[model samples]
Target: MTDIPRNPLIDQDVWTGRLFGGAEGSWYTAGETRDVTEPATGERLTNIGLARAADVARAAKAAAAAQPAWAALPPRDRAAIMRRAAAALERNLEHTAHYVARETGGIPAKAQLEVAEAATQLHIAAGLPLQPQGLVLPSTVGRTSYARRVPHGVVGVISPFNFPLILSMRSVAPALALGNAVVLKPDPQTPVSGGFLIARAFEEAGLPPGVLQVVPGDADAGAAVVEAPEVRMIAFTGSTAAGRKVGELAGRLLKKVSLELGGKNTLIVLDDADLDLAASNAAFGAFFHQGQICMATGRIVAHRKIAAELTRRLVEKATTLPIGDPASGTVAIGPLINARQLQNVDSIVRASVQAGAVLEAGGTYERLFYKPTVLSNVRPGMRAFDEEIFGPVAVVTPFDSDDEAVELANRTEYGLSCAVIGTSLNRATAIGDRLKCGLLHINGQTVADECVNPFGGRGDSGNGGSMGGPADAEEYTQWQWVTVKGAAERTPF
Candidate 1:
């Protein structure tokens, strides 16, 4: 294994303290500290400060105190600050990417892409205030009415480890742009890249103190933020099980919440599709980021006429991809986030193969690294076909017709993402429409995401809320109706 180059620009300070309102330098010493390890090598990276309930309370109070003034600021002025933050992120992109690679086991190239995506999201969010606002309604005689959008007081943002930078900013950027204060809780696994890097960006950008707070900890810190009465809303991105718990707790408290949960996404290839294109898309979608993405291509449904050819091409593509240490800078597949993830993926692959699914390509693991794997003859009852195997694994199932393909794709409880590849655009579009999912692609894989698009899912995936574009402002803010009496003279009681 080649030694990973550590960017000297990043130091221990980047992993040290939790941010409080206006006090960017304040370090929280009241909680227990935990060691963060590199998933690629199991080496101790750094010890991170964990925020407990008391720390959550302090951050919430500070956020609540600062929200009103931030909301009162003119929209353009607030946008200017966000733009400055975007610049700061760009300036520190290399350091942030290094942290992402070191902590999450992402290859340096992909890590850089994540950081660039975050910067783009910040820039996109900076324009939120300039977009159209609430509507003016027709009122009854002698009265005029209009509705105005306003921010939630304080929003709690809980993000997962995979794609930490992009996921965290998906909520944080919109909340801040909509004039809401944020109490962000990043996953313990990637605290420095997910939380601290974000805090430093805003701090350098000169955002007003107390508008943003980052608390890095485990479930205790996450629960603290959710239980904080001062937090009016919660925007969360993680596993469906965790999201359900968050939704249940927030629902009981009557606090607004948006959850971007899991997915057992599918990719369909029709009889008339280009086999090579389909194979390429499937390989990239299933293996990129080691298949840690929520929208990774978990299932592939191919028409019987082309199923065999597609499987052959997929195997050829999957086996050729380089796999090794992420720090090597030459490998395509990196390590899983931890040993548990590695074990879980291995178990599923073994069980699926034992249950009649044929292992076509790579299915072996060396410590945290799992090779890109492909399974064929996968049936509905097989675990690989039904479950979300969040690893570099792709399962292929044969379908007789388009109707059967749609049925197979929609059979899962998760309706997060899907893709249809066919020679005829109209047929592909029709097939895509029938797949019950939030995000769909006509000729590509289920992996593309844009800051300007509504990024979320349906069914067990989420609760009918989105996390990007102008719609996000609506999710993080509320509406108020105002009326003015045109000809009021006197009141009679």
Candidate 2:
């Protein structure tokens, strides 16, 4: 296995390989590279190759050319390759965590978790090739008929910087496993963990040439992926605004598109609930990974009877949590991904406070480490309530009844996930039924994902493109109906 070089010497060719068959992206030959800076310290981690629109088109064409042979391989052979790829990916997890921590400003634990989850996704993808691809159907003419799922030829993937590894792997692994070629365009902010590493793993596991093309790039490469005729489908994970643009372009080209967009999720607290447990769950949901997750609880709608107490608890927890360079020690929260992100988060906090929300705990920062924050009296029009903060800020509001709670939870234009806290499962389930998000957690936090459960959003959050077993089957393949018989069939004409 080609170990991801750990020397930190920033060798351009070593980190960003220029080979076409998954070892390197096509853009490196042009000698135009982008600086990947560490968010925590503003240190230049490495200079990664940048992909152009032409490079994306080239990669897509290569991936399309390689699909037939890859699909022709036996399913068992494909599955074995997938398993080996999973193993190869596992070998790099430990060192990869350090890189992720530095590049993305995530704590060691968060980085480790991302690596572990990425490996798990690969393991799940290993079985995708072996799963039954078709269903037997009865024919009107008494002929043996069936419907089979076939690969989409080439899939173009555009991933984000936050949770880079798992987000990119979930789509790449399944598409590759189901016999589809892929041209991956990871966010330029996270080329290493999101693009090159996964491609290298597959290549090391004996994947044939041209099956996977890694393109680490910015908007030009992303636009090229959607516009390239060879890419039959698009799997994009990013902000809602960007996702809408992707969907628009893919739609114009008549391409199959799966969009995993942003979220302004919520967690509802009941009057009869345990405030301590609810507060704990809310804190983790709102501040975990510094609330950069799509499923992070953006708003906490508590019962008016207990809103004050919950707000106090949240404030206490937020004020005490450690904020520093996560690579230096065990900090509860790390820096924002970059100065841009830090400014955006700060703006939201400042705007909300100006718009009448009370900042109970924090609303300041030193460098990129924005303190975990708590805000009370937040209303729908405030930036903290309406916008996706994508930071370590929890906005608490009060709802008088279950109906009001449901109304508050469902008010956001984005509907990705929601959580309900109540004394009994039946009570929570009753409240959960009214919330109109794609994923729900009764008496739990909103941040969760597994191989079995479908992951996606609703409304502005996404366009019904989810990731899971059933979703993988549908997203990675197209349907075809076939009929066979001993005798010649009659022609309708």
Candidate 3:
């Protein structure tokens, strides 16, 4: 295998100390450090800094101290910072794109798309303050009342490694626009690509010092932020097991929480559906980003009549995807994030074979590249069908009826996302509504997500973030009611 490129020392002049102490706008390296390896070739690309729980505490304290003044700023002024940050990101898109691709094992095209999406979210966030519509109730029984939206004190944003920039920015941009100071803790695996760049943007935007702090670390640091009493809300996106732990910590502290956890999502195709579109969507959803997405369509339920054809088409399309260096523009599939992920995916493939599942196509894990794998006759009881194989693996099953498909789709404890494809719009709609998932797409696999709509799970999949729609924004904030009574007509005790 070819050796990966070494970390360019372009930022050598940039300061390196504590990732948490950057409240003064001067960049600081994170406290603890770890080596980042190229997943495919197992070569060390660079050394990344990792923060500690102490760092998280310090960052939370900084955010708590700065939140009130930042919140007091006029809404439009806060939005102006978001717009400025978006502009800065646009200017540095190449740097952001390259690092994101290299650090996360995501293809260059996907990285560029994520960066663009994040910039768009920032633009949208920049517009929120101008559109804060509150209810003005008419005078009732000789009294007038109105509702007001206000920012929460401090918000803790914890994100995962996959799609680091877009997912992390989705929460941070909105929170900052809403006038809340933020403590952002990105996954250690892609710390610089995910967190440092965000910190730099905030500084370039001229945001008030301490309004945003980047602290990179592992689950321990994440737990610190979730358990911090000063944090008004914990916004988290990660695995179900880890999310549950964070949620419990937040609950114990009585803080509001947003949890975007794991998913074993399913894609359903009826006999009457357009086989071409269904096959393409399923193939991309299952193999794109090496199936690292939280909402990847891992389980495919095709109509019995069309199962054979759909599987054939899916295999044909999936195998054609190119797996290579993530920085290469031509690469469609990329390596798994790390060795552990590759091993985990391989174990599942082995277990599925042992359980009598038929491997339709590639099922080999060579280094970090797990061949674009397709499995057929995956029994419901098999590990491949029951658990989340977060690699380029798709398990296909056949359903004779819509009811049976829905039942199979909902069988797993997760209810994150599902896509239904059928020729009859009414039939697809009925099944889409019936499926137990947070986000449902009819006639398509899970497409790229937008911050405008609520994107999360329904069941054990986990609670969602509060920055999507108006209701979601309200969910993140607290309401203070006011009553103005006539001086002369005050209530007589």
Candidate 4:
């Protein structure tokens, strides 16, 4: 193993196998540790402590204990703290971006984007508490009735390694704003930058102790967080398979769970669409961050009339994207998270080619750096078209008509997001309205997400619950109806 150089951006002492928890700002060391490696160079960045099941329980208890005081504070007060946290995040943006780039194998530009998105999410969540909650109901002559939103006490957040900061904050910020305490477990692969930095931001922002806990660990720790009795709700973002397991466990415990899972997102281009714009956006949506996004465009449905031109343009664009070390600043695409992911992507490409899909641009790799790949002639039966290929590979299939386009788009079990590109906005809107996905983009890519939008999916992509804007506050809370009766004029016989 290469000797990892010290990163000026991170506190070496704090990052070496320490978990953050409690209001006293204490750090605890676990019995076992795991080495975190940089995928760009296969160098061990640092050893992270793995939290055990007991640790999860302890953190949950602490969050539960701290929730009441946090809930007791006025919404504006909570909002103030959240805003301060956002400011702290902005102040540390440079360091955080560097850490994210190195740890997650994302290019500096994408890492910076992630940090910016996280800060924006925090700022948006700050305003959630100020939004109107519940409603007054018309009642009988002498009675009044109303419903109010209330916190769910302790919320467990399980975030994936890819886009860890944004995904975690999707739940943590909203949960905090709604007066619920949070116990966060970031993916073990990206504990320091993805998990620890957010904890530090909150601590520096003067959040009360114990209200927020950051525990970094493997699957055991994740299961513990789900099984903990004190965790009233769980907000999870990961693979569809893992999400099912979380849902099953949380269901057994009768805990409310919100899941954001995998997607085989589709991007459709009509015959009248500008081929250049469609190809460029498709390349961006498919290859951005090595295509490690849930909303990445995995499948492209194009009108048969323009399919050849669109495929040619996409292939031309894919070959020019820089793929190298993330820290170099000039690279566009970086390494996959690990060898397993690299193998998974390569195998999928190889299998699709063997199954009769034509590889138009890229189908090669050295170590973890995969070339941006575009596969044409992809049919319905090919795995590349049917499954979620979480890599920089775009599979294109031709559709004869608008009805055929909608049919092909909705054929997949996953309905997370879809994009429609066409010359006419009215035509695009007409097609988008017919799509079954949770999110739709007209004349754009499928990966765009706004800070104020309720972000999530439908069908296997997620539950009906969303993760941003005012809807998030509702997701993290419960409703309680309060009724008052005037003095009775007569007694019952």
Candidate 5:
């Protein structure tokens, strides 16, 4: 806030140069620093410490040191603390959401939606502490046997820039609720709303210092988390290529891992589908938060009979969504997260248009503000169809039959979410059955998530892991088999 102009919304105390290592959420100022940028204006937001491996090691050490006592707390007691954490997050929603909007260049509405969802994650996790954590097993040897769920001790989390708060909390809150201490490394792009704000919430809620670490850092810090011997598991949300690296490194260390990666999601419009319903879902799915969501519909496969009308409708809607800076609190869509993302979106659009996809509505940008675009006659091989363009672009490809629609949808390496829109529930259900995605919607859109429901992806989209109370119970803990015999049973050697 000294040289960099203080934003009226973003609190200066949260954006300072101090880095909060996981060691009880204490400030660590010994490191090289980098500037956080406001994507809309290409201006410096604030300087933050650039964390190296040593910083992560310190956090891991703290988590490992603090985990046992946290785990020793009564289950109901832990639940009480989790509820307090959720309340703390709720009280600070508006204040932290301002940081999310400015830092990610997302509309205020979108930022608030994610912030509210993040708090919901904590609330849902608050119920996990009292759930039965072990199963009674049958023993053939006349000995009582049991399988008990135990904390992995320390968990390392690496969250992505897009949808930062919820993604990080989806892992962090549950791990804490289930008694595993966590060291969270939020994406360097959105450290405050993603990392610092979460740390502040938990600290205010009286979570033991060192139980949840917030380290805003780069790849070196993430790698250190995975490599630390004291850290028993890794929960990462990022790109597929990056997920692969995290998986490989964690595998070599024989550690537990959960990865939520990229998506090239689709929505199918049957001949029987209402054109208005299909077009509305397609536009919202493709352009919400500038299509930065992992569940954003990248392709719309419509019946040949209704494809033209659907495309026309999408084009009409696309031109009407306001596009500009979110700080103004007026636009539906805001700037891309950064210059590189802007370039990537533009390149894919240009290449797809050159390959013969009709640029029906939008294909231009002013600075980082890429217009909500709709394309028709898109094919499987085109860049728009093949790559995950995490931008506000929608592509429509016509399918002659249900079989062909299923074929077109399953062709991608990513199988995250799919929507089948038709009046007939039976018909939609059949088509949804043939699709290879982890999440399916019938007579609905692909962009949806509820904290209580098991949500995840398959193949490149994720490692078949989910985020919910039940899924969290499985992912955050390890099972130990215990057997007991009267008077010390003897075994022949």
Candidate 6:
């Protein structure tokens, strides 16, 4: 690899590796490599080695072979390693946060939050070893039985670009803690930042090789990892369309799959709710990370009495957000990942305008920086109202009552997350329950929090994977029931 910058983070002599067992601290480099560019400016950030299909297969094979040894280790021992890794991450908090911000265009404060969250997830996963709970099936049909959770052998993780480090950690930590070997396929855009940091920490903590492997490449490389027979389970987090493709391949291989896909999440505001707080939080949730999050509040449904007031407050808040370089502490907004995402956001906003939505503020696009935009009077047939824009754009619509608001919220096919704002706790809780989403927030905006429980979406948003609690550890595993009926009693028929 050629050196473009003298930054300490960039590794010269570009090398990739199969981070599975028996190959402790081994470097595997493909002859081909490419340059990674920063979104804000077209400067070269780093040079990354692109792993091919063959490299993916080899990584999977290594993980598969290492599974038995990893699973055989005592749960406490495994937990100790994970806890050490978390400690290591905590020590290097500054560098980790800075690297994520520089590469992913995330602001310093937000990036710092994600780094801490990643560490907390590791800490939570560390607790999994001591909390293995199983159900007793006392004498079912003349046989005493019980159900136990077991590792699913070699599992594959396909992560997304937005919130790369935290989201990947959310999946990887639990899988590894549950005693399963993991082959992590990081998003190509922000690959070096997340996986590289994790690998370094794991090595420093003396984690067993092959327990966690990271391969950085494009879709072809990801597909190779998913299609491998050695990979028994696939945990994917990305767009709904891409999730479908990965699901299809996993289905052909009869592999277990967990998907957390796209969403057009809604922030419902009632007439009697706190308009100022809701507007401020809604602005942050809708535009944070350039509105690329799966659970971002892309659609805002407001009660008619307060719709105009909330819209006015939201537009005012969006206008004042300081947009600048991601590294600057004062800058709250950052550039989009690349040109494609910027253009996609632009196209969707244009369509929303054509469908009767009125622009509230900020529609200028200069390079990767698309101004934080808000639209009013958005109707059903527009792409912005229903589709995952994946950019800094929000579509606002008004509803008559709670029933009509719930109906409008569920109008889209995606069901990842939603938020309700109201003065009455009982009414808000009741509305939250009726809303069709994996996670519902009352009087507060949604965020990917480690302490809070995580649930995957239904419908096109994808389903069946969680990252926080004891149940998260169970999801990464399979089950095996063994019955020892007094050594079979040598029963002869």
lDDT per residue (tens digit) for residues 146-265 in model 4: 999999999999999889888888888889988999999999998876688788778777789889988888889999999989899999999998999999999999999999999999
Pairs in steric clash, model 5 = 22-213, 24-210
Tens digit of per-residue lDDT, candidate 3, span 354-453 = 8998888889866788899999988799999999888999889999998999999999999888999989999999999888888899888964487688
Residue 201 error, candidate 1, Å: 0.4
Where does the lowest 10-residue lDDT sum fall in candidate 6?
1-10
**Lowest lDDT block of 10, candidate 5:** 1-10
Q: Write the per-residue lDDT of candidate 2 for residues 142-202, one digit (tens) a residue.
A: 5899999999999999999999888999999899989999998888888877877776677
Residue by residue across 389-427, what tens digits does model 6's lDDT show?
888776789999789989999998888889988899898
Residue-level lDDT of model 5, residues 77-180, one tens digit each, is: 88888788778767767766766888888999988898889888888888888889899998877789999999999999999888998889999999999999
Q: lDDT per residue, candidate 1, 211-237, as tens digits? A: 898888778888889999999999999
What number of clashing residue pairs does each candidate have, in the order they appear?
A: 3, 1, 1, 2, 2, 4
Candidate models: Cα lDDT each: 0.86, 0.85, 0.81, 0.88, 0.87, 0.80
Model 5 regions lying over 4 Å from their true place: 1-11, 22-24, 140-142
TM-score, structure 1 vs. true:
0.95
User: Which ten-residue region of model 4 has the weakest summed lDDT?
Assistant: 1-10
What is the lDDT for 238 in model 4? 94
TM-score to true structure, per model: 0.95, 0.95, 0.93, 0.95, 0.96, 0.94
lDDT of 5 at 242: 94
Superposed by TM-score, candidate 1 places the C-alpha of residue 172 at a distance from the truth, in angstroms, of 0.5
Ranking by TM-score: 5, 4, 1, 2, 6, 3
What's the residue-level lDDT of 241 in candidate 1?
90
Between 1 and 5, whose TM-score is larger?
A: 5
Q: Clashing residue pairs, candidate 1?
A: 21-210, 22-209, 22-210
Best by lDDT: 4
Candidate 2: the clashing residue pairs are 17-24
Question: Which regions of candidate 1 fall more than 4 Å away from where they truly are?
Answer: 1-9, 17-26, 485-492
